[model samples]
Target: MRKYIITGLLVWLPLAITIWVLLWVLGIIDGVFVWLLSAVQAVLPDSARASIRELHNIPGLGVLVLVAALMLTGMFVANMFGQWWFRQWDRLLFKIPIVKSIYSSVKQVSDTLFSSSGNAFREAVLVPYPHPQSWTIAFVTGKPAGEVGDQLATLSGAASEEHVSLYVPTTPNPTSGFFLMMPRSQLRPLAMSVDEALKYIISMGVVAPASDALSAHPAKQPAAAESARN
Candidate 1:
């Protein structure tokens, strides 16, 4: 009886959680649609409002509306005039003192994450952290830029050597992490893709990428050769 019950739960638990999550998200989106409908109905004649009362209860309407709005925005932003307007809008945002700082930082991060040509998170790496011989998986964001790179070079007395920026995400919650800048020679590049590494991290190493995959991608190369190739 115990085995049967455990097996049944194993089969059903994931399905139940997934359904619950989907329903919860749908309910929240539907609430937005309901609020918007109520606002519009406030100014409408009673008879007209009554005629459209059924629309207020429609599930997933807000999701549809949100998708449509995003599509329209994308279409609008694809043109020359739209690009000019966007630049002007960005300028206006930059004029605000506090808002500009927050907005600019977020925009830069989003651009790097979403840009097609961006190199952020392109490779997975391993580096010693907290102590020697203890290593953690990290994502290579890019090379350190501007003053940070210069300062690191000066401190290390290796102005000619390149330093790469990495994010070492914590297990189970990959969103929060430490940002590190280390010389390229120290990082051990891994064969795993960003998605595969993420899965390993999020699963707390229980789910690992295949070792065979690493065979095709060498983890280490001579620093001199790497610098020369780059």
Candidate 2:
């Protein structure tokens, strides 16, 4: 009976967690819609507020509204008129005091990570962190560019050696971690995708790539060692 119960739990645990998370997210979205309705109600006269308040009780309305809003916003922002308005709106936001500081920082990071032309988190690799003896999993965000790369090259003293930009995420909370740079020669690349690396990091090594998996650039290690010797 105990063995059967354990097996049943193993099957149901993931489903339970998945449902719980979805409900949590739905609650948050629904609350936001409720708050928006309350705000709208506050501005309108008492006689006009009932209709808006009535819609707030509808189930799944917030998710639909949020999805529609996102789609419409995306469609709107795809054109020249919207582009001009967006730039103006961006400028307006930057003019605000405390809001600008928070908004600008988040905007820059989001643009870097989500932009089509950017290479942030494109590849995963093992990085020698703190010491050469210890290594950590990291994402290859992008190399230092233009002036930063030039300065690093000048400071590194190894004129021929190249460097890579990496983001080493902490276990369980991958969002908060270190941004570091390492020599391209020392990096041991992985065949896993960025998503796989994130899962592994967040799981604190419990979740890992398949045993038979190969490195993305396994041959580069020997070549790099050869170049180091030369």
lDDT of 2: 0.86
Query: Top model by TM-score, which number?
Result: 2
Per-model TM-score, in order, reads 0.84, 0.86
Candidate 1: which stretches are off by over 4 Å?
43-48, 215-230
- Tens digits of lDDT, candidate 2, 145-197: 79978887887555777888999888899889998877888888777778878
- Candidate 1 at residue 40, lDDT? 91
Off by over 4 Å in 2: 45-48, 211-230
lDDT of 1 at 134: 96
- Minimum summed lDDT over a 10-residue window in model 1 is located at 214-223
Clashing residue pair totals per candidate (backbone < 3 A): 0, 0
